[model samples]
Target: MTYCVGMMLDAGLVFMSDTRTNAGLDNISTFKKMTSWETPGERAITLLSSGNLATTQAVVSLLEERPHAHGERDPSILGVPSMFQAARLVADTLREVIAQHDAAGQQADSAFGATLILGGQIKGGPPRLFMIYPEGNFIEASSDTPFFQIGETKYGRPILVRAYDPKMSFEAAIKLLLVSFDSTVKANLSVGAPFDFHFYRKDSLQLDTTGRIDADNPYLQLISQGWGDALKNALESLPDFALE
Candidate 1:
């Protein structure tokens, strides 16, 4: 299991993903769920994946190899003319990997399935975000749906639904995400730190910020502790029902 989020904002895009992969009690491991592609002054793209580890890894490897997989004549993600095309390419590749796995004696409905959140800016287009499903279809994020999450998403979705702001600064966005991730971590054992984050600035055509946050990090500690206190205070502040 995993938890990953990608938010589309006026400032750019914000992404967060947990590193924990829990196969079983003794098989837990940490693996990065975020990947990026960059061509300075041309384009920048980031992908957040969750689900079957083998499927997601294969998708990522194929995308990384796209440049060399085909000679100069092949149009790789870096050469795609628009963000939409880049997402389509990702979806296609993911579908292919799953198909190959199925052909290799795995059942069509095997556990080897994955989902992805793709967001980035192409040179000629504004930043865009998409949630690519295991079936090779995807949906774009819009003002009404400005973010996407995959894998164990329920625990953290309300925070985003209630407080997301299109005009929020990158810093504010990150703070919001931290609180959300913290809430999820408290409720679920399948997700844990060190969390990974990436920020892409609009039209900058470069990644603006990237970092890992662990359980002991001071600011995260603040958010986790402070949010709990705030919630308790809020509940107390509300009027209690009177016995009739």
Candidate 2:
């Protein structure tokens, strides 16, 4: 299992994914779920994937190979024209990969299947974000809903609901995401460490920063601890549960 999210903000985009792929007890391993493609000052795109490992990997590998005129050989995200076009290509690629895999005798149902969060910008357009479905369709983030998450999102959604604001500055959004990730890491064992974060400022067409956050990282620890205590304090102060 995995957890990956892409947040669209007035400031730019925030993408994050946990590297842990928890198959079962004794089967855990780290596999980066974030993929990036860029043309430096021209375009920057990032994808966060969740679901079947084989299916997702095959989809991405084929996407990188999409440049044979039919967009079947480009291979990576770096060459797509616009963020919207890029997403369409990603969705189409995912469908093909799933069909090809299962057509040869593998289970590839759309439910409990792979999904992706795609985000970034082209030099001429504002940064945008989307959540791509297995069916080769997607929905973009809007001013009313400036972020999207795939996989185990329930654990972290409350923080996003409480803190996300379309008007927040870049730094503020990062802080919000950190808290959200911190909450997720604690409540779910299926999602684990070595988190990947990509921060882009709108129009930069270049990633401002990308880094791996592992366990024992000081700032993440602080955020986690603070959020835990805050939740406890809030619960303690709430009116007691009423008897039936």
Candidate 3:
């Protein structure tokens, strides 16, 4: 299991994903679930993946390999003319990979299934974000749905719902995502982090910032402890229920 989020903001886009994958209690490992491609002054693209690791990796590999493969007719994510076309290329690659692994082919419930969050900007269009499913279908972020989450999403969604502001600064957006991730890591054993994050400023056509947040990071520690204390204080301040 993993947790990945991509948010569309007026300022730009913010993405984060955890690095944990586990087969069982004794067989847990860390693998980065985030990948990005950048052609400065042209485009900047990032993908966050969840579900079958093999399927996700293969999808990414194929996308990366297409441009270099001899006689490759398909447009690479980097060469796509618009963010929408880039998303289509990713969705198609995801379905192609899943079909290769599963005889059933592109079934959402198939063992080979994976889901992806694709977000970034191409030279001629505004920054865009998409959630692509195993079945080669996707939905873009809109004013009505300003974010996308894939994998272990339940534990962290409330924070995003209550607190997200489209107008917020990029700094505030990152802090919000970290708190959401902290909540998820605490609730799910399969979702431990050393999270990876990317921040893209709209029209920059280049990745503005990217980094990893480890389990022992001081700011993570502060947010985790501070949020807990604040939540407890809020609960305690509420009127107590009395059984009649």
Computed on alpha carbons, the lDDT of every model, listed in order, comes to: 0.92, 0.82, 0.93
Considering summed lDDT, which 10 consecutive residues are worst modelled in model 2?
A: 67-76
Runs of candidate 3 with Cα error greater than 4 angstroms are 104-108, 236-244
Please give the lDDT score for candidate 3: 0.93
lDDT of 1 by residue, 38-75 (tens): 99999999999998999999999988887876566656
Candidate 3 at residue 39, lDDT? 92
> Per-residue lDDT tens digits of candidate 2, residues 31-85?
9999887778998888899998887888777766554346445434666667888
Ranking by lDDT: 3, 1, 2
Clashing pairs in 3: none
User: TM-score for all predictions?
Assistant: 0.96, 0.88, 0.94
Q: Give the alpha carbon lDDT tens digit for every residue of 57-90 in model 3.
A: 8988888897778777879887889999999999
- Model 1: which residue pairs collide? none
After aligning candidate 1 to the native by TM-score, how far in Å is the CA of 104 from where it should be?
1.3
Error of 2 at 80 (Å): 3.1
lDDT of 2: 0.82
